[model samples]
Target: MSAFSLSQALAWIKAAAQSIDANAAHLSELDAAIGDGDHGANMARGMAAVTKKIDSAPPADLAALFKSVGMTLLSSVGGASGPLYGGFFLELGKQSAGKTELDAAGLAAVLGAGLGDIRRRGKAEPGDKTMVDALIPAIDALAAASDLAQGTAKAAETARAAATATAPMLARKGRASYLGERSIGHQDPGANSVALLFAALAQACA
Candidate 1:
């Protein structure tokens, strides 16, 4: 699709919820290796709340939809993920305010704003072995895309790859940082969740 509308946005949210639910165990497994083991369950809970809130009330506008999702995540999720993901979506809503649909460039702008908010909230850099590793590269890929579908697909690929790359990096942030060199062999749970988010977006676009 050349443009993303409310329907597509809702689809993206649903897809994200489903993906998180499906991979909840795997996420927790990943987290158990390096950080706290609640990442999977927490993310699944937050996404489910977002889905329920959106389905029950049904946002009147695109911005409202994203804002509702953000609020739901903030209220439902736990740990650092709650605020980080919530802030990201809130920034997305802010960037998309007054717009009913987003073209390629609009999508890029929204994603970029979300990434910036995430970085700011987490005080994370690309090599920090945090979600930023996946998100920054995904945003870069999206920025070069010509349309929503292409952008989402490219973002998914880059995000997954970035998440994989995190396996070899020593943690420098969050709970994983406490592991020191021991963190190098494990994949970051937050990065994996980010990859799933982009993958869901790509599936929605498809």
Candidate 2:
């Protein structure tokens, strides 16, 4: 088994924050095409809070780390994303309670649980022009891998492609859904952000 440490998980959160900050403008631009333009600002702010909270508190275990990330994002971010992402992490924490190390399958289980929370809360399906478009395929790729390194790397790649693929899809959920036909030809910001998250996880494992 390839053991993943708590420090690696912590690194993933920090990298995610940086990725959000770096892509904030891009995210908002994508949102503006089909929904409200505040997605980037809200995500950046929430991720900053997540970074600050983790840096100062330094969670002792995987569950605590996931909880800190979940609670911080829930309170700090605005709009639908806060609850979705926050609930994702909260569920991840719950599933991973008392765990400190992860093999490929172990990591997949926690991440799968987190994605389940997002789907349950948002009710988005594949090809819905939502984060589910990116997340579902990415997790599937991960689940098919033989090791943590390969899984994460493949997941990240799948997520990016899935996010890009959302551009041609008609929005069927969230604020973007209200745009109807006009939502076509625009990428889903939530999907892109989810891609960024997988990228961060891949980076952490690297």
Candidate that scores best on TM-score: 1
Candidate-wise lDDT, in order: 0.93, 0.92
Shift of residue 77 alpha carbon in model 2, Å: 0.4
Candidate 2: tens digits of C-alpha lDDT, residues 86-202? 999999889889887988778887889999999899998888999989988898898888788888999999999999999999999998999899999999999999999999999
Kindly report which residue stretches of model 2 are placed more than 4 angstroms away from their true locations once superposed. none
Location of the lowest summed lDDT over 10 successive residues in candidate 1: 100-109
TM-score for each of the candidates: 0.98, 0.98
Regions of candidate 1 where Cα sits further than 4 Å from its true position: none
Question: On residues 1-206, what C-alpha lDDT tens digit does candidate 1 reach at each position?
Answer: 99888989999999999999999999999999998899999999999999889989999878998899999999999799999999999989988899988887788789899989988888998799999999988988988888889888999999999999999999999999999999998999999999999999999988
Task: Give me candidate 2's TM-score against the actual structure.
Answer: 0.98
Cα-based lDDT at residue 146, candidate 1:
88
- RMSDs, each prediction? 0.7, 1.0
On lDDT, the leading prediction is 1
